[model samples]
Target: MAEVSAEARIEAPAEKVWAKLTDFSVYGEWNATHTSFPKGPPASLEVGGQFEENMKLMGFPAEVTWTVEDLADTRTLAIRGKGPMGVNVGTRYTLTADGDATTVRVDGEFTGAAVSLMAGKLKDSATAALNESLRKLAGLVT
Candidate 1:
């Protein structure tokens, strides 16, 4: 399995950050790297709720399905998802209050046939994307 983890400190409160993070609909607005996403069957963000999205990964368009596996109000959120590219992605977002700011960490594990071959490249790419997205997300919240 290939994995990547990136973190950033945003000048916002945990609650504020969590509110925005949990609202999956606005992901496109903040996450510049992702393009396509599901349209209908509006999904709720419950522990077991699921959502589907289409996005470009490694220059290829792929469909991904994500299921909420854990939630911790304003602290952490975790999900398990799979993409049409034969990639299984496990993602986790953790928020920690730091004096008047919030430290956000986004980590992911990419597994399966597609990712198993180029483990180093996959990890590097995911880390880059996550870092970029975290910077953008921090800017949005702050």
Candidate 2:
């Protein structure tokens, strides 16, 4: 398994940050790994909601079928997905408000046989992607 995380303090309120985070319509605008949503964003965002996302990770393109595992308005969102080559992917977004600023953290994990073959490289790539995603997200909201 490979795990990665990134955190950033954005000069914006939690509400503003959450709006941009959950707005899948413009997800690609800031999300570094996102290539496109083949069927668009999910109609509703709730536990069990499913969506298909086309993503590029570790320099490879993949289609992942994701299910919303958890959600909390303006606070948290977690999703688990099944990717190619029997890989399992999990991502979580967390937001904490501190007066006028919001601290956002993204956590990700990849597990499967494929991951074992490239754990080190995958961690490096994923960590970079998460940091880039957070930077872009901050630019949009702050």
Candidate 3:
């Protein structure tokens, strides 16, 4: 199992940040690697909601059909994705309200055959990419 976590304090309310992040239909707006994608159907935050997300990762077409594993409004959102590579990845977003700013934490876990081989080399890159994305998102919201 390989895990990567990144946290950032966005100069926006927790609810506001959560709204923007959970808006899977518009992730391409602030997420650099996920750009050039179109909005999709309305997907809710819950324990069993399933949806498809198409984006670019490392210049490749990265698409995943994920299911919501857990959710807590303005605090946490967890999801799991399964694929041929046996990739079982999970993303957790935690929010903390600080006056008018919200500290958002985006954590991810990858467990499977593909990840086992290159876990060490990928961790730093994943963290950097996620942190960079959070910075971009902060700029978009604030």
Q: What C-alpha lDDT does candidate 1 achieve relative to the native structure?
A: 0.81
Q: Give the per-residue lDDT of model 2 (tens digit) for 44-72.
A: 79999999999999889999999999999
Best by lDDT: 2
Native-referenced Cα lDDT, model 2? 0.96
lDDT for position 106 in model 2: 95
Please report, as a residue range, the 10-residue window in candidate 1 with the lowest summed lDDT: 33-42
Candidate 3 lDDT by residue in tens digits, 1-142:
8899988888899888888887766676666556432346445667898776665544446666778888888888888877446767777878899999999888988788888887886576667778888988898778
Q: Pick the candidate with the highest TM-score.
A: 2
Worst 10 residues of 2 by lDDT: 36-45
lDDT of each: 0.81, 0.96, 0.76
Better model by lDDT: candidate 1 vs candidate 3 = 1
